[model samples]
Target: MLIETTAWGKLEIDEDQIYHFSKGIPGFEDVTEFALIELEKSSFAQLQSTQHESISFLLTDPFNFYHEYEFDLPDTDAEELDIKDAVSVRSIVTIKEQLELSTINLLAPIILNPLNRKGKQVVLHKSSYLTKHPLWAGNSILDKGGE
Candidate 1:
């Protein structure tokens, strides 16, 4: 299928690669379907909405930046995605930029089913997590051999 995107321009996307977010993201309830487009050889990805060409989000694997990152989903969410094991899940963080400070929303991670291409953005109930966690903070930890 051919889709027009603001970031990647018009591109070909496999029908199977389209992910259906039944509940959509926090603010994008009406925008459900999306395609995860990798940005060349970079670690970043663009989650482009299939329904709306104007709606898109820059995402990245939270674990790559934050090794200690951990979150437990409610039973309802796990059941909704039909998650069987840990390997079936992929977590992504939404990126945000403000002047010199860039941030990622770690508190609400978008979980995807690699096998079926189903996805959902889940909000962590844990108080320890922050919505605007600095992605660069993990670099300092890695520099200190903290992993």
Candidate 2:
């Protein structure tokens, strides 16, 4: 399974590594298949669209930046992915950068099923969350506490 990517160029991916997003990411409902590729020695990953070479997202675990972060998907979403246990769930946030700070889309997290290679970008209904939450600001909070 060889495919061309926006950032990684041409690479080989296992068929099993291909993830099926029945309802693709926001603004990309038609794009379904994607493969997760990690950036070398970095916490970031590229969610490369198998359907479109130009369509790829930079993603990371929000928890890595914000320890207090939490998200809960609706029961309907869980059923759609056939999710049974928490162990099968992996969450990633789309990265965004501003002039002052770097942010992550916490309101809509990409959830993946490692075993079945299925995924979904779920929009959380919680009011406390934001589409662009500052990941770096969260770290600054911890630093202030340490001081």
Candidate 3:
């Protein structure tokens, strides 16, 4: 299918790329459909709303930036998405004017069930992660041996 996006203009996307968000993203509760487009040679992907051309999010695999990043997918969430085997996790990224100041929202990760094309932004209620973590903060920790 073809969709218009502010970032990429008109583009062709596959049916498998489209995901259905039952509860939608945090603030976009009404928009239930989005296409997950991966950026070549980059860890980032664009979650573009199929309905709204301008409504899109920059997402990245938190693990790419933070190797130690871990979370438990509540049983309820797993069942809701009908996740049987394949699952994709991505964090919303906020890019700043100063590239180094970019932050990623680790507290709430976008989870996708590839098999069913279902998605959700699951909030980690018991996690120590914050909504905005410096995009490159993990480098310092690794540089200091996780001190």
Candidate 4:
């Protein structure tokens, strides 16, 4: 199938690439359908909304940078998404003018049931994870900017 997007324009994709977010993101409740597309020459992926061209996000696997990153995996969420196996946990990333200044959201992770193409954003209620975690080890973890 082919879907038009603001980020990537029109492109061919498979049905499996489409992700359904029942409640959508925090501010995007009306836009649910989206497609996860890999970015070229980068580790990030685009979670592009199929309905709204302006509603999209860049995501990345939290473990890629923060190996010790984690949050409670509730059984209720698992049951809701029917996530039995092949779970894809990704975090939303905020890109900056400079690549190294980009930050990723660890407080809320996007969980996916790959088998059923179901997806949802799980916000950590107990953890101290911040919404804007640095994507790289910016200057000995002291500086507020890029790595």
- Choose the strongest candidate by lDDT: 3
Worst 10 residues of 4 by lDDT: 138-147
Worst 10 residues of 2 by lDDT: 138-147
- Clash pairs, candidate 2, are none
Residues 16-70 of candidate 3: C-alpha lDDT, one tens digit per residue: 9999999889999999999999999998999999999999999999998889999
Better candidate by lDDT, 1 or 4:
4
Off by over 4 Å in 2: 86-100, 138-147
For 1-147, candidate 1 gives per-residue lDDT tens digits of 999887667879988778889988888998889998878898788889987888988888888778888767788898898777742333455443432245567777888877767899888884577666666663333234421
In model 4, which runs have C-alpha deviations exceeding 4 angstroms?
Answer: 139-147
State which candidate has the highest TM-score.
3
lDDT of each: 0.74, 0.74, 0.90, 0.85
For candidate 3, the 10 contiguous residues with the lowest summed lDDT are: 138-147
Q: In candidate 3, how many Å is residue 27 off?
A: 0.3
lDDT (Cα, 0-100) at 36 in candidate 1? 85
Consecutive 10-residue window with the lowest summed lDDT within model 1: 138-147
So what's the TM-score on candidate 1? 0.83
> TM-score-based ranking, best first?
3, 4, 1, 2
Residue 49 lDDT in candidate 2: 92
